[model samples]
Target: MQIIVFIKQTFDTEAKISLDASGKIDAKGIKYITNPYDEFAVEEALRIKERLGTGEVIVVSLGGDNVQEQLRQALAMGADEAILVASGEIKTLDEHIRAVILAAVAKKIGFDLIIGGNMAIDDGSAQVMTRVAERLDLPQVNQVTKLNLEKEKMECWREVDGNREILLTKLPCLVTTQKGINEPRYPSMKGIMQAKKKVIRKIKAAELELDLEQLNGDEVKSVWETIFLPAGRKQGKIIGGEFPATAFELVRILHEEAKVV
Candidate 1:
């Protein structure tokens, strides 16, 4: 089994977000980590390879050179190899272009199965894997929580509207991982040391022979006009009194002041 796990580097969940003077996310001082859901995908791929006793788990990502850190992390987690699709001179890449590049990479490097996170934590678009699947014309299952692989096909369970939907797809399919699939394992010291010696192959997006006109086109599926911080939450008011009086006051506040009732 040859598994390819598509990963992304995202802002750390706990990192503070702020906008620059140009009204864009300030990436200057922010910390980055492997997308949490992508970590699950990488771990699942490693597990599948281990279970089969003979297979390769390859982790791939697209971004600037900084993304190599996240790729190294995945490599340390037991992926047999890593590939970095350098964004090159492109400053802003929407999900469509990203998907096209990734799908091209998939074709360049064949795989038995492809996995990725359900959505990136930063943009939360959840479109890349779906678009890749569409471009590749392969069966795809999203938000998979349970997966069982066989010789010719894979059976998986995904949650939709609080209910689990079972799906069976043939080999060479793509799946986006969700929570509750498997706990990601931390990279051991030995794995970390070995990862230092592993060479990550870097491929420029231009080398993929994507349509240059499309790459430089102004048309995009979506655009972010501007971004700003959400309004801060208001402080809570506490009314102290006896039980009935407090309950009565609370109801009055809800009905009148808060107007929630």
Candidate 2:
């Protein structure tokens, strides 16, 4: 089995985000790490490779050169090799075009299985995996929690409506992982050392044979006009006194003060 895991470098969840004058995210001086959910995808891919005791686990990412660090981390976690689709010029492209780039890469490098996060933390866009599947003409299952692979067939359980749903798909399928799939392993000293020596193949968008018009086109269907932090939360008020008096006061506060009666 040749499994490919798609990962991304994103701002740490705990990082404080701010917008620039152009209404874009201000990334200067912000800490970047591998997308948390993608970690689960990497872990699940490595686990599948280990279970089979054969084949390779290749980690792939689409971003600027800065993403090499995240790819190295995936290598330390047991991926055999890595590929990077360097698209620094089109860094702000929409997810539709991003999925096209990924699908092009997937076509260049075939795979038996593809895994990625169900959603990216930064934008929370959960469309990439499905789009890639559509472009590749392969079936996909999302937010998979449990996966069992046997030969060309797979049995898995996924989360839906706060409930679990069992699913089965054949080989050459894509899966987007959610939390609870498996605990990600920390890179040990030896693994880190090994990661430094692994080679990460880098390819430009043009090298993938993508359309130039698509790269420099005004085909965006959605736009982010502006961004700002949420307003500060107001302090809560306490209603004093006992029993009926307190209840009446609460009702009065809701009807008059908060105006939510």
Candidate 3:
């Protein structure tokens, strides 16, 4: 079996991201990490590969050359190879067209399964995986908490609203794994050493033979009109009183001010 994982490079939430004069968060000088949700996706692929005991795992990412680092990390965790799609122009969180383009590339390269994180934290838009599936015209399962495969069929268990649902899809399906799907294994010393020597080939958008003008002509990928950090609020001072009085005051605030009651 051959598996492809859709990974992304995102700003580490712990970095020094701040709003610039343009009112947009600047990525300058910020550290990058693999999309947190994609971790589970990668682990799921590796686990399935391990179960089969004979399969290839390929990690794919779309971004600038900086994303090569993320691919290397994936290799350190057990992926056999990595593919980097470097489009000098950036892709928006909403467009998620990049993932679709990646699915096409993966199809050209051939894969039995394609997986990604349910969403990215920086954008928190959980639409890429499904878009890829749609473009490929394959069955897809997102927000999956459990996955089981037997020969050519896959069973997926996902939590929706507050209930669980089961999804059955054929081989070569797409999926976005959730955090609890599996525990990600740490990169061992030997794996890390091997990762250092692994080749991470980069393919530019042009090399993919895609038309540059059509990149966002039909429908735009991502858009942000304005962004700003919320103003910090002052610490609250407790209003002490008798139990009933305090409860009445709280109720009054909820009804008159907060308007929740």
Candidate 4:
């Protein structure tokens, strides 16, 4: 079995964020960490390789050079090798363009299974992995809570709206992991030392043979017209005096002032 896990670096969930002068996230001096969901995917891939007793787990990420830090963490966690698709321009590309690059990478290196987080936290798009699978013409199951890889097939339990669906998929399938699938393990000291010796293969986006103009052009499906913070909340109103008067005032406010009724 050859397992490939896609990891992403995102802003720490608890980090304070502020908008820049242009109304976009400032991102300066912010701490970055592995996307939480991708950690689960990495753990699951490691478990699958261990269970099989013979396989290589490779972790791949697309970003600038800074992403190599997160890829090294994946290597420390047990992935045999790491690949960083390094491109400064990649940081500005939308989900569709990123997916195209990932699909191209997938085509370059075939795999029996591909795993990724159900969604990235920063954007919460949850679309890139599925889109990569679509471009590669592979079956994909998102929000997978349970996975079992047998001799030549995979059985998975996917979480949908208030329900679970069992899916049996053939080899060369992709699955995006959701939370509660398994607890991700921290890199051990020994593993950390070993990771220091692992070499990360770096590739530029231009090497992927994509048209630079099209990737940066209007072919992107979505456009961000503007970005801004929600307006500050207003102060609460008080209906004073006796209980009956307060209740009547509340009703009036709901019916007339707030217009919620």
Candidate 5:
């Protein structure tokens, strides 16, 4: 089995977000980490390879050189190899462009299975993997919480509106992992040391034989018109008095002011 896992680097969930003068995220002093869901995808790929005892788990990512840190993290988690689709000089990469690059990489390398996070934490678009599946014309399952692999096919359980939908698909399919699939393992010290020696092959987007104009032009499906923080929440009100009086006042407030009644 040859499993290919797609991972992404995103800002740490706890990192404070602020916009610059130009209405873009201020990257300075912000920390980055592997997308939490992608960590699950990488761990699952490692587990599959370990169970099969005769397979390779390759981790692929697309971004600037800074993304190599996340790739190294995946490599430390036991992926056999790492590939970085360098987004050279392209400042704005929308989900469509990202899918184009990733699908192209996957096509070039070949795979028995492909896995990725249900959605990236930063954008939460959840469109890249699905688009890649469409481009590759392969069976795809998303929000998969459980998976069982066999010789010729895979059986998986996906979450659907609070229910689980069981699906069986042939090999060479793609899956986007959701939570509750498996707990990601932390990279061990030994693995960290070993990862230092692992090679991460970097391929520029131009080398993928894609039209540069199309990729930077119409391939971008969306653009960020503005970047700003959500409005701060209003302060809460407290009603203090006798129980019945407070209750009556609260009801009146809800009915007349808040209008939630």
Candidate 6:
């Protein structure tokens, strides 16, 4: 089976991000790393590869030209090779739906199992993998925590508010992973050295031949209606009246003066 792992490059957690005119962050000289959640997806794919013993694993991403750096990190960990949808232009989160275009590209490459992180660190939309699966029109599972290859299907466990959800999905499905699914292994010294020499082919977005018109324009907007912090309360008073009297006074103040119950 051929497995495709999707990875993303994102700014460090503590990055001092500043929005530009288009509401996109300036990435001119920022330090970046693989999306932490996607790393788990990569580790999961590597584990499956080791178990199956013989399968091709490929990592891919759509971003600026430098995105190949992130793909190399995947190669160092265990992926056989990588592809980058390099376009040298920054894309906003909403605009990232262009990944749908990549899905058609991946279809031509022959992938049996597709995996990606739960969300991009910067965007955190947790939407791409599911959309990619939709574009492919194959079965898809999102934010799975436990996954096991069973006799006839893939057993996936996802977290819910009060219980765990289990599902059995057929092959040729895309799975998006959260961090708890698997612990990504650190790259060995040998792997690190090899990564420096690994092959990373650049595939321009235009070459992918996706309909760019279908990839732009979003209607949702965060107006921020108001943007101030909440007000802190003043010091509290220890009342001297009887307990019942104090209770009555407290309720009165809370409702009449504070306008809160």
Best model per TM-score? 5
Please identify model 2 stretches exceeding 4 Å from their true place: 235-253
TM per prediction: 0.90, 0.90, 0.86, 0.91, 0.92, 0.78
Q: In model 5, which residue pairs have backbone atoms overlapping below 3 Å?
A: none
Residue runs of model 4 more than 4 Å from their true location after superposition: 90-92
* Alpha-carbon RMSD to native, per candidate: 2.6, 2.5, 3.1, 2.0, 2.0, 4.7
| Per-residue C-alpha lDDT of model 1 across residues 197-235, encoded as one tens digit per residue | 999999987788777566757635666788999999999
Lowest lDDT block of 10, candidate 5: 88-97
Model 4: per-residue Cα lDDT over 1-261, one tens digit each = 888999999999999888999888898989999999999999999999999999999999998888988998999998999999876765357888889988888778879899999999988999999999999999988899999998989999987788889999998999999999999999999999999898899877788887767777765777777877778898999778998989999999999989999
Model 3 / residue 43 / CA error / Å: 0.8
RMSD of 1: 2.6
**Segments in model 1 whose C-alpha atoms lie over 4 Å from true places:** 235-261
- Error at 210, model 6, angstroms: 2.5
Ordered from best to worst TM-score, the candidate numbers read 5, 4, 2, 1, 3, 6
Q: How much RMSD separates candidate 2 from the native structure?
A: 2.5
Model 6 residue runs over 4 Å out of place are 20-24, 89-96, 213-261
* Candidate ordering by lDDT (highest first): 5, 1, 4, 2, 3, 6
Q: For each candidate, how many residue pairs have backbone atoms clashing (under 3 Å)?
A: 0, 0, 1, 0, 0, 0
- Return whichever of 1 and 2 wins on TM-score: 2
Winning candidate number (lDDT): 5
Compose the digit string of candidate 5's lDDT tens values, residues 85-151. 9887566788888888999999999999999999999999999999999999999999999999888
